[model samples]
Target: MKFTATQTGKFSGPGFTARCVLGKGGVVKASQKREGDGASPAGTWPVRNVFFRPDRLDPPVTSLPLVPLKPYDGWCDAPDHRLYNRPVSLPFSASHEKLWRDDHVYDVIVELGYNDDPVTPGLGSAIFMHLARPNFEPTEGCIALEQNDLLTLLELMVPGAEIEISF
Candidate 1:
């Protein structure tokens, strides 16, 4: 999959067009909100991993790529912290943080390789591709689509799938 930013929006608070590529399911319009700045970051990124609801009878899995969930999993957005662009557990003090809330959002996620320069602290963390709201509304820095579409994309995905967003 590949994404291109056809316009500008905010991810971490900056202008960036958020054009995304669905998993062979085509394109779906989505929205994002920056953690602090409320500006969407624009650029090329990769699908790092995938997660789904464990309580589900049979959570969907595909060749796109998968990563297990841990109690300590978290996404750090503290641009000022030493581990700014990586995933960190609790006991942290970052200004902008995604604590991997037990909510459905993180329950099914696909981490994006935005600023994953070295992969250690990764580029801005917590980017994912998960279920969208019934209204097909915007997101808080993640891509979203209909459940069926997502499932289809997952089935057609492979590890190292490329996601590009252009403006």
Candidate 2:
């Protein structure tokens, strides 16, 4: 199955569509995507895996691989680091994002296959589809959707499903 998230803030797949929020800087071509630029890379990226906070919610039901998030989970975003664009344990010295966030937004994270292949330094990192804030605020670089909508979509996604993010 294939899903799509557009610049107009619509996320659709199979037979359902829901509002979504993109990066603050909007969407850009994958090649033009830069670290910390606040723009979501525009392209079709595979759904790598799903990570959810077990303390906050029960494991989500989906065909995709799922992992319960650990408090020590983190994603290295420092371009200069060897582990850039990869998951790491906490206390990581390099600049990174704490996957175990205090905010509800990261409670349900859909890891997207962005900047992980060969991981070009500074291209981008930690791009995911996660729960949106109450007001549907823009994300740093990931896509955001309401909790219920995201959960519903996850149930319909298949193993090889990919999300096409476009302008």
Candidate 3:
């Protein structure tokens, strides 16, 4: 099943509808995506994989490939680097986003296939579906959900599942 999201924070799947928090800058066309724009790219993104903080919770129930987030796991966002938009080690020389966060947000992370295939420079990167704040605050450029709601979406998602976002 595909997960569809609206600007109003209602994220719905085939058999479920869960509230979600979108990017702080709101949703925009894929062409409008930029490095640090804080807008969620509007498009259909496949579920690439999942990364969870195993030390915090059990593995989520899902068919998509799952990997435990390492303390050194990070995503390089430095456009000039070859590893840009790819996972990197901590203490990385280039600009990167830490995956092993101290907060609960990265505890359950679902990689959204966004600007990763070719990893174009200046495009957005590190987009994901992750745990939302108690007040459902806006995200950097990801779809945020409550822990339980995220788990539910995970359980419902299958291999090749994609998320379609619109304004």
Candidate 4:
């Protein structure tokens, strides 16, 4: 199954008509995607493992590899760092995104396979499909979906499923 998103901020997959909030800058081609651009890169990317907050909710049922989010977990977004575009333990000296967020947005995260192959610095970092805010606010460079809708998608999704973002 594939999750496809449109420029209009709507997303569709095998059995769902879920609403998604795109990046504030909208969607762009992968070549145009830059670090902190706030625009989702257009292309098909594999669905990697999932990260969830155990304290807030039980682990979701899914075939994809799922793991619990630790308080000191984070994603290194600093382009200059050696671990750029990679997960890092908190208290990292370089700049990184703290996975332990109070907003609950990071409570459930799907780390899409974007820029991770060889992780080019300044291309982008931490592009994920995560829980949306109450109002479905625009993400930094991720696709945000409502929790229920996301849970449904996760349940039906298979390992190696791809997310296809188009123009």
Rank ordering of all candidates by TM-score, starting from the highest: 2, 3, 4, 1
> Which candidate model has the greater TM-score, 2 or 3?
2
Candidate 3: tens digits of C-alpha lDDT, residues 39-132: 9999999999999999999999998999999899999988889998898989999999999988899999999899988789989899899999
For model 2, residues 1-167, the per-residue Cα lDDT tens digits are 89999989999989999999999999999999999999999999999999999999999999999999999999999999999999999999999999998899999999999988878999999999999999998999899999999999999998999999999
Which portions of model 3 miss their true places by more than 4 Å? none
Q: For candidate 4, lDDT tens digit of each residue in 56-86?
A: 9999989999989999999999998889999
Clashing pairs in 4: none
What C-alpha lDDT values do all the predictions have? 0.54, 0.95, 0.91, 0.90
Number of backbone collisions per candidate: 26, 0, 0, 0
Error of 4 at 63 (Å): 0.7
Clashing pairs in 3: none
Clashes of 2: 0
Residue 78 of candidate 1: its Cα lDDT? 71
Query: Candidate 1 — what's its lDDT?
Result: 0.54
The C-alpha RMSD in Å for every predicted model, in order, reads 8.1, 0.6, 0.8, 0.9
- Model 1, 38-96: lDDT tens digits are 23345567777776655541466687655666666666677667777676777677754
Those runs of model 1 whose alpha carbons end farther than 4 Å from true positions after fitting are 1-35, 56-59, 118-125
CA shift of 94, model 3, Å:
0.4
